[model samples]
Target: MSPVEPSTAKGAATRARLLDVAARVFAEKGYGAAKFSELISESGLTKGAFYFYFPSKAALARAVIDDQERRWVAEVQQRVLAQATPTQQLADVMPAMLELLAREPGAWSVVRLVRELGADAGLADDVVKPMDAWIALVAGIIRDGQQAREFRADLDADGLATVLVGAFDGIKGLVDSTSPEDREQRLTRYTGILGDMAFAELGILAHPRDL
Candidate 1:
């Protein structure tokens, strides 16, 4: 059976409340460690109300991951990429994601939840994978950069976009493994290293920190 969608203002508010509290809790405590009771208590929703909106922990986790990742992606394009030129936008992408992660608990929650709820989790179909939006954004950036002669015209934009996005996501995990004090600097350095090696042949490379 399909879960009922919120039809009234109060119902919508209740659902939003649950997602907000759930994202924070899941970010602070991994999905396995987060308690359902605490989610209900912190959200100020009764057990009955919680289940009305979300049928199970898996259901709620799916909603939270999808919702938060969509918001994160929109914010990246609207807020982070809005000011930069196409070449600059390409450089800013990974470092800006780390900067957002530092301030946004919701982004971290998506990261944890995405890892926890992979294809075997039974709800993967519902997720708006962050990588898809990022790859599209990078592809657009490459196209524009190529038009401006900022990126090489010899390469296919979408192909280069896929490679760079994969590289960025992988490097991000590496940055996360370092000590807290070293993480940000490492992110900038790693992104720079990626730019140096990857973009040097193809574009006018700028370290993300420099941009």
Candidate 2:
């Protein structure tokens, strides 16, 4: 790829900042509650500038979903699935995800919205289908583990993948209802439990001393 000019880089950075700020605001205040006027104020961008990047609130919301999927796939799913060993895969991805969510609790809101989108007929075609495709890609990684004999043949990899992702949603919900300290503590416990379950289900022997 050709090097980006300094001005281009600056423009890209500004756009990213606006997206991040908009996502946080939308998650904190529902989509309906979020205002483009406020977004411009908080982003320190003129209304024309904001419109240049995102045409409307609906467009911004779509950008938020796309941005979220890109990060999840890049940061969590791709890293784990790239590992040679399934055990290492789980270890790498699980902790990485927890760390990612810790950086932004607003992730919980995004995830919940994804689920809602999946269930709504109005959103099912446009919004939910793309989100489901991303999920299937993540789930496919688990199926690959099963095919490799790294995971139990008897267990349904697709079903397990759904459950695992669903569990994260549940944990996020729990955290949203508690204090930050308690949330981290609970998340640690949840991660441990998930790691144990994966090992047990896969019939993988834990490291000698850890067992």
Give the TM-scores of the predictions, in the order they appear: 0.83, 0.72
Query: In candidate 2, which residue ranges exceed 4 Å CA deviation?
Result: 1-12, 27-33, 104-109, 112-134, 177-181, 205-211
Give the range of the ten consecutive residues with the poorest summed lDDT in model 2.
1-10
Model 2 reaches what TM-score against the true structure?
A: 0.72
User: Compared to the true structure, candidate 1 yields what TM-score?
Assistant: 0.83
How many clashes show up per model? 0, 0
**Tens digit of lDDT per residue, candidate 1, span 1-211?**
3345799999888787788889999877757888878887887777887788987777788888767767777877876567657767777677667778778766567766766676454656555365688788878888888888878899888888888877876676555534557766777777778777666757564644566
Clashing pairs in 1: none
lDDT by residue (1-211, candidate 2, tens digit) is 1112225878888877877887788667656667779878999988887777877766666667677767776777766767776556765666777777778745654654554454667554655444454456546766666778776778776677667766766666566546656776698787678767766766777831143
Q: What is the C-alpha RMSD of each candidate to the true structure, in Å?
A: 2.7, 5.3
- lDDT (CA) per prediction: 0.74, 0.66
Which structure among the candidates has the greatest TM-score?
Answer: 1
Candidate that would win on lDDT: 1
Question: Which window of 10 residues has the lowest lDDT sum in candidate 1?
Answer: 119-128
